[model samples]
Target: MRNRAPRSRPLRAVFAALTLVAGTMFGLAVSAPAHALGNGLALTPQMGWNDWNAFGCNVSEALVKQTADIIVSSGMKDAGYQYVNIDDCWMTGSRDGGGNLVPDPAKFPDGISGTAAYVHGKGLKLGIYESAGTATCAGYPGSLNHEQADANSFAAWGVDYLKYDNCNNQGISAQTRYTAMRNALANTGRPIVYSLCNWGQESVWTWGAGVGNSWRTTGDISANYTSMLSIFHSNVSLAQYAGPGGWNDPDMLEVGNGMSFTEDRSELSLWAEMAAPLISGTDLRSATPATLSLYTNKDVVAVDQDSLGKQGTEIASAGGADVLAKPLANGDVAVVLFNENASAQTISTTASAIGISSASSYTLNNLWSHVLTSTTGTISASVPGHGSVMYRVSHGSGSSTGTTHPLIGASSNRCLDVSNGSTTPGTQLEIWDCNGGSNQAYTLTAAGELRTLNGTLCLDANGQGTTAGTKVITWNCNGQSNQKWNVNPDGSISGAQSGLCLDVTGGNVPAGNVNGTLIELWGCNGGANQQWRLG
Candidate 1:
């Protein structure tokens, strides 16, 4: 998420300093809270329904009531699904005489208070939306200048949750915008769960816990598995930021929203594996029983809601198949073996791979099957193509398991050469001095696109250029063969653009002089000159 544009004037010197001190004090208080709302505000991987995906900007009080009814009638509420959140566009064009926010009279004739009353009567918590910026993402009036008024209004309306977004005000720093809302909520004395929606801008994970109950760490999630996986994997490194009173939200769940379920289990398993907020974006009123079953799986929910509050990380992958390993509070490890390939593929992992080795014995509880099996020191299973097998591995002796970084090649010595650094999308590709900057950080998206850390496009040769010295530059992503670059275990990147590896042009040796050196496609010769590490 980008930062909003600054609209308000700067604060006075003393007021600014006091505000900073207040913020620090607030951070300390929240971090060391004696109690969080009720036993901590962290959602064991928040499982609820959000209206954004299905309803978009057309949310209404009747719609929320209807959704709440469906949630209870469909048995999802009984399955530990609690929140019925209204995403965006729930506000009217104007505020009331008392300076309180009013719901859209046409869509929410009973107003927000009535809507909240109805939702509360249904035995469900109510959540609403606002923008930290001047305008909401959906163009509705935001709470940018009306933080206290809106917060008080929400408290009066019995709101239990608030999804505050960062939309139009692009000039304000995320900390300032988030802090304003936090202060407003605190002053209101309402126990509203504050959700900071900054799209991961400005290192939100670094400070989100001090400001909000949950924070979005990625862009909006699509219904497809690839999109969902991309968002989930993007935040793997920030997992440690999540704890008892805060969570890293990877957007909402897309199950049953007309996406393929061939490996829907893999998606759900990965979400649970990451301990991500699991706000369902599907229509509960018309969802299939199978979908409901997926949502109501208690075993998976247990993994997500683990009291330890530890998020999972990727263990390994082959081709498109990958494994994610998460450590539970109970000294058990949750492993999700996923095959994201279009065709069937076998995936297997031993307990040793996830840093678990014992006296030749272990117990595996398959979360989907809700069954248990005893296996030797090595635990291996055949994961179907586009599917996954989620297991909770417990030690036979009930001893605590040690955790190593689960990702393969995570701690490897590799350098990513960003020869031409620019904020622009497409620039000439070249080898440069490695300084471990944002320009050097590359992310292999779940959609198979090699993107810069700031979400810029990574380009390939317009045509297959197998010959050496093929120039590379950024281009709009079309998922072409040339656009894909595979990072091998040895720190060499092979470009799909020409089926050739990225080579340091002419073996440039100097540090800063390598900045403008051209990048070329060459045959893999296993030369140290050609190997580039992703530092």
Candidate 2:
């Protein structure tokens, strides 16, 4: 049974004094490197089980003990579920005389330290919750004014993980608030995995690596197919920022939570493709065999735990059907074909489509089946509506290495300019003669969205096809499929909206008039117009 709030409490003056001291101690600013907080602790995708979706604020010492017991006995521990997290609403109204934060006496009579000891005794790490804002999203006390005190208390309690949320933090820059906690944690000299949960504010991925170990790249995930897919899609553009010690969290796992199986499988596959964390958000004690099987597939888990730590990118989509691909550390590739449509759709993709050379014979491992098969140069699979099929493709026999430049850096020598006066949307984009101009400098975000050095969206031809004459232009940053462009080494740009390569229509080469030339999508012709010099 879920634990509820107590009807009565003892009013204590010591609680007030502890709060005052905590506020006073944290009021002083500390100077340190901003990235110091995430510098310590586990550098891999955190594998854990959180008690929020199943129990919410109704958690108790008994409940935690039962969950911990189940985690140890259920074989999830051997499968890599280590951290047992207690999220939100576990705090008491006050701190103790030792300057240590107290857990709600009714729910945790032994305090947080006792809970940590118990969890550690089970050979699992312990994780606690806090908020950077004045109040948590669930309306509990936050660490806004108690950064140092909270950090000290948490460290003393032997807390191994901290999921710092962003809620009710008004009038404060996220950087400043995060930096404060970071400094506080560093002062304690304890290694804690600081997870910055801000729902991707201020382009968190762009700077999150300099702050926390992981950042929530999207909003909360629900226990349904639509909700899970929506959250997964939202993070597609930010895939590049995920890596060792820094990850783009798509929220906790919904496996074995009584959600639809199709949705659960799709969610698992997509998360694997993105290389996101696999923290289970289900009741381990009552988990069904199917759920356990789904969560324990070592083959699929390998994709999530790939050493390369590179996030996957979407290659193409048609009629709500999309294909996403990620390069693995073993030089193989992982592919996810998703059918977001109302009905089933057959999604097809080639190795070359995802920047890999076509193999004579490829070993295709179906992540869902946990089985492997050999296929020729081409492979196709059918995906159900709101479902996905994930695969690991490797060379079956011979390895053919090809020169592929998936991404290009923008520098003084390699850059090209857009025609002057072509800043508006739908303007034809061309690779002019190389010049170290501001217009030539651009940054490709991990989300695959192209932006000017100052952060303006580089759009595709009305967000559609590879036809000859699709114009490229600049627009405000909106995460539309059309505004996402994948830079290829063949000196061509492909639109995420249509999977069409940016072409110099008809290979036109007049100097100044290259401005109004029609931009179209075409095959990789290796023409001077198709080859762009990235600056």
Candidate 3:
């Protein structure tokens, strides 16, 4: 939400001398029950432009208007990027005498209503911002004690979305505070997309769906490769907490900012696969054709807008290669093969292993290339380092059925071979040449658990380590949180404990083949050490 943009706010007493720094917004009214409010605003992740990441407190009506115009004239509006959000710094230094928030006339001389009208005329919606706390992050007035007046003001202004941030919030229940805004929005008799920006405090994912249309699952996103990938890894595992209407936001897009071309593609592709919001955080008024093209890539957009709201699951991760699978309503599955390693990688997985239908053959359509091919239940690709490839696969007319097999590594060309034939808790996992050993066989259950079918043990993130480079081991099944796992659509398996991904220690060619190099948890760096191919 910032150039170091402040996060959304929390409820608290107003502060003195409110400094100014802008955050973000999308709609005015209407709401969701963590179930995306069933209100029909962001049925798919909301696509729009947010100002915080680009301009911060420098936001002005002129900039917003020009941005909205560019969104339409550049074909972004036609491509479904319709919301023109005004993040922070749009409010006056003080509210009106009626205790209502006021727009700063110096910045918005025609006022919010005029801006809203102008945006709506272009077939776009207007969004406003407020903090749950007494002050927004930059010290601007917040909604802590003025939820109703604020909501009323926004509705009257024809605001279509509301980005509620949490800053300056005195210690209070996030549930209670966020619910206050939720109820307030509902009372307005208008449809607003409620976005909760609590920065993951209180595991917002757990209760956010019942309150807001989308909840930020991470901290702010910077315009760089590491920050973007870091957020992606953090949010992907929380997919289960989101459903129709409610989404888990991984922060805004950084595609047009500063990352490499390949990295930008990976960013866009991964966000689409995850079903997260696609709010642009760039200077759209000066965007290049390449930037606009990346924003409007039809194939990527289609998979993201697919009616099926299910977020993709990470099917496999080892040595920096991951596969995430999103089931589409069209009986097709959208798969993204991502290589997070420094070098290019050739990864593969079977339709059945990734949770697609067990049909004998699958017809593959490259979403990026539009290339069509028929596979007999197997999908493979050579993904560039730090880049990704996406495809839509449907059941083919061929007669082969899907099969289950061991996960094989690319660099080592070894199976997810176990260190020993033991099924006890604490058994070490390693990559060894394929031998069809019973130990090498594992199952990714619908419950998001990777288990030894015959052994009855679940893969566990040792000690529930949340930091990068934790140890992963086997444990007896217990319904505890740490034992749960998520197969992200990026081909990485993230544990429920810390949401850190599975990694191959010293993940290199020959060293990775050694029986026990300590397969551990690590920050998902997209290295080959975290990649695996399901046979």
Candidate 4:
């Protein structure tokens, strides 16, 4: 926890100072939190349902009421799912005569207050969505300059949560815009949980703790394993920032939308392991028993709602097999053995290696199977393809082992090399002859970073650039998204920040694709220049 000074100073001044110091002294784009939002909410990651992924702009009061009814009948409410959030398109395109946001009468015949009353009567809270821009993402009236008026309308409607989005902002800073809404919500004197949805740009997590109960750490998640895996790789590295009051929101859960049952289970397990918000984005009315089982598993949910409030970190990752461990309040660690491959594989880890104190024996409680077993130290399981095996290990310690290998260009058969073997930040990366040198040995870290030179520096996108021609350089590993990479199955290495592939400069042409060619970020084509093999 960071220490705070007197509140006599302005907040923007404080935000600027902290951002500067964090960048200059630590090489980090975000400053550590002085404290999370003091609203006394979101002590645990928020678990609920949001209508966006499944319904989109089709949200209506009837849909929310039906969802709420099903949630209660399906035993989800008793299982700790509380909020029924209505996403965008709930309000009119224009504000009312009094400059207040108006609920679409066609959609909400009884108005928002009536909808909130109906929801509250069912023992669940109501959540609404708005944007901090000139217009909402759907082109509806936004709260950019009418923060107080919009916030007042939400509160007057008895809203308990607000999902503030990012769209159509006319060149304002995220912090300034979000802070204005935070202040407006506070002035309403309502205990509304604030969620910042800025699509993860601007390093929101660094300053998110002081501004909102939760901040998005990535773009919207789709209902597919690839999208979920990419988002997970990006979010798992920033475990140090989440706590009771604020969390790293990786968008919403995509379970029951379209993915297979195995993938759905993996999504739930990983999200719970990371202590992320479990806002369901599926239409619950037609949910299957398997989907409900994955959502209502008390033991798995326990790990997410644990009072420890610690986000899990990757303990071991290699060859598409990864392990994550979250320390629970009861002195047990929740371990997830995930397989990202297309075939079944056995994953293993030791109790002592996961941070548990030495013990005579340890108990492994399988969260999905509800089976209890004893292990002296070794914890292992057979996980199916695109699936996960989670366990609660009592008395354990963990270790991380990253594989160091040369990334060989698939076309030229040359190695990805650090220029002149320099360890300095901003040193260019290139392709060289396949020589077994330390400069050519890159370690893929649990944080999704490619680190070389004994893990001191990372492969970074030049100046956080997202363009096609951004230079790929070596810089100190600072836990920023620009340093994260997704080594995809098709042999393409794409940056988490830009979604651009790492390419060997001029590799498309045989003449310029030779040794000593510099590397860069480019559009992901199936060409050999963008393809790589790690060995």
Candidate 5:
């Protein structure tokens, strides 16, 4: 990652450069090895239970112990669910006699040490939380000026994990603050998995591996399908930043928190396929068996914990049907057919495009149903709305080209269609379901023209507006700067002329309100509404 905030100060710049050199020396030594740091911890994504997504500020010692007990009794412990994390609001408003943050006596009557002992007794790890700022997200005491004392206190309490947050820090450099906690944790001599939760500020993925075991790559996730879709789309575009010891956390799993089963499957499969942390974000003590079944699906977890530790690449994405392929340690490939469409549709992909090159016939193991089948060329499945089908595809050659296609938003099950299918210049684009119309089709040419299949129209910024909120439309194929868009590696489509991003207007809109939301050019802010995948 970019040497993380190089500056004019010679000493600080050298330290930053040294940190970069240390990670680089090893990083280049192995050609993207599974363990970038060789940190001996989080060899795969951290498997755990987090309180905030499930219970928020209502966390208590009893609740955490009960969760630990349920995790043990439900056989989730054997399934690789390890840590039971107490997120924000677990601490008091102030610190203790030694200036160490304190757990609220009333809520955590036995305090953090007792809670950690109880969790550890059940063969589970304990995770504690604090902020890099003066106060946490819930306004609790933070470790801004007391990183060493707080880290030492956590170690004394036998904590096994740490989630360092960022909130109300007066805009201190995130790199400096997070590096402070990293050094603090290291100085404690206790091996705790560090989780950086700064809401992906300063593009944390660019420099996070050196600071923590895993880092959040997006905003928090809600118990809504749109939130999951947004986070999934964002995480898929960041596959290069993760490995064995470090991961790109798109928040935690919301499987049992009232989203649809299809969406839950998408969340589980996408996270596993992408090698994201599988931290359960549900009230485990009261969760139903069905929910645990989804969470502890052995086959899906198998893909996530694979020794290869390679985050799956989006081999194919088009027409709202996406294909993700991850190479496993056993020479087989794990492929996921992700359908972000409103209706169930048959999506297919060939094994060669996914990088499997060996045998003539490959056996497919269904991660969900345990169904086994064989395919000679293409594997296909009927994926449901907002759902996915994952398979372990074996025996195929790795020599083929993948064609990219257009991806439409799932909230409305629509394509990026032209206004009334008009060929006229200045015809604005709108969302409509895919009917294979020529106006709805687009080809991302090597020269950056999003050309229609009919070969007449190209995407253009309306009226040559160079400001935010400029609507984009289809116009005659003229080679002008306004018609060129860079499909960015960060999953954004930026205008070559204005340097703005093609964005969806509704910022975090309520479910079902995304239809007809104007597509405009805005300053690139890396919002989920602005992210796009070239299919």
Candidate 6:
């Protein structure tokens, strides 16, 4: 859930002392480089089973044990699925006398430690959830100010992964609250993979790598094509922010949650293509053969677990047809042709467009059909609606052409301007009448920066700000994260530093189309103000 108003909690004397010591010891402004936490966890997107989508608050010790047993027996363990996570409501509504979370006796008779041991015995890790607020989404006692005590409790319980959620956060900056937990987890001397669940607000991806192993890039996903497609579009653009030890999570896999079989396959394919964490949110004990097959497809799972850790790029997207290509470690590329229409559509792209070099011929290995075919250069497929076709291409060749184009706002139909056509650094960006001037022509480079002014000035976030409404300016090309941009498939461009959209200021208003509307970074709301097209 997104940030909500936190409930008032009466501070106990003992908990106060503990909080004071924690704040003094681990609170001296925790910061890290733009890389991951560097604890050597989550080198690739995490593969696991989480219980929120299928079971909700109905989790119990028996259910968790049975799921772990089934994962091993059903070949999922061999296919790379590991963690078995318990979601919210695992604890009682209140804390104990020591200000520690207490597992519900009815649900976890042997406590969380017992469950963790049982899962560990099966050669799998255990995960648990907690909110960063005074109360969880289900109204259970949360870790808000008690982050230290809670971290200790989880470590003592042998927990291997932590899913920290956003609920009743009291409007605190996500950076401050999440950083506290990251510090607390480090203090415990245990290796716990932290997963940030802030629903993508505050551009978490901009700094999530320095804090946690994975961060959600959108709102929760439902089991339908529309929700999946929307989340996919939101996440597919943030590829530059994802790599080893950190990822852009698009929420869990809703494979068996009532979507059609084709839609389920597409969800898995797109998630794999995006290098997203593959946490199955379904009841494994009752999963059908097809659902299990979708979860345990070694070929598709290999694409997700590829060592290159490069998130797929959108080669071409038009109408309801989309093409995505992810480069693998072995000089091979994984390609997907997806159709989002109501019927069937043919999608096509060349090997060169996907960053492959020319060769005598290209070998295409169909991931789903397990069939082999040869292509001289073009990769095309007639895909069913709500379905996808994925392939592993080997020994292919292609080249990319660089082009500069004008970025037009979807709402105002104006050009992105450099504010008086200044060449100086820190000249704030704006929207003006589209005259096709050099100021409006920006070239998106393979390194992910948007360069203009004859490739001298790159689009940058002023002061390296990671919050919404930050000034968007032009700076000298420096190859920094603040200057990187992701041109998304939904006609929106987002900053690699902030993960926020390049929005026309006040563009949601009636007078937003004036000749000189300033542009800034803001939360992506799917509004016309945040949408842009390049041509």
Q: Rate the local accuracy (lDDT) of all candidates.
A: 0.69, 0.68, 0.76, 0.84, 0.77, 0.84
Per residue, candidate 3 scores C-alpha lDDT tens digits across 6-116 of 333221111100111011133433232346456666778899998998788998989989999999888888788978889988987787888888899999998999999
User: Compared with the true structure, what per-residue lDDT tens digits does model 4 show for residues 213-284?
Assistant: 898877668889999999898788778779998998988999988887678879999999999999998889
Model 2 residue-pair collision total: 12
Which number leads on TM-score? 4
- Listed in order, each prediction's TM-score against the native is 0.66, 0.66, 0.69, 0.70, 0.68, 0.69
Location of the lowest summed lDDT over 10 successive residues in candidate 1? 403-412
Q: 1-535, model 6: which lDDT tens digit per residue?
A: 3234333221322243344346558875423237758988999999999988988889999999999999999899999999999999899988999999999999999999999999999999999999988899888998999999999999999999999998878888888999999999999999999999987777677789999999987777888779999889878877878999999999999998888767887899999999999999999998755477678778999999999999998878899799999999999999999998878677889888899777878987767644456789888876767778898899843221146778777566678999878999999999888897889988878898889988889999999998998999999999999999876543467898888999888886548757888889999764557766554
Model 5 alpha-carbon miss at residue 56, Å: 1.1
Which of 2 and 6 is ahead in TM-score? 6
Colliding pairs, model 6:
352-398, 356-397, 356-398, 357-397, 357-398, 358-397, 358-398
Candidate 1 per-residue lDDT over residues 288-403, each given as its tens digit: 54466567777888888898888887778668778788888888899887777666556777888876645567887766643345777665665545567788898873211121
Q: What TM-score quantifies how close candidate 6 is to the native fold? A: 0.69
1 against 4, candidate with superior lDDT? 4
- Candidate 2, residues 141-173, lDDT tens digits: the string is 788988999999899998988998877777587
The per-residue C-alpha lDDT of model 5 at residue 75 equals: 75
Question: Which one wins by TM-score: 4 or 6?
Answer: 4
Report RMSD (Å) for each prediction in the order shown.
Answer: 18.7, 21.8, 17.7, 18.9, 15.3, 21.2
lDDT, candidate 5, at 462: 91
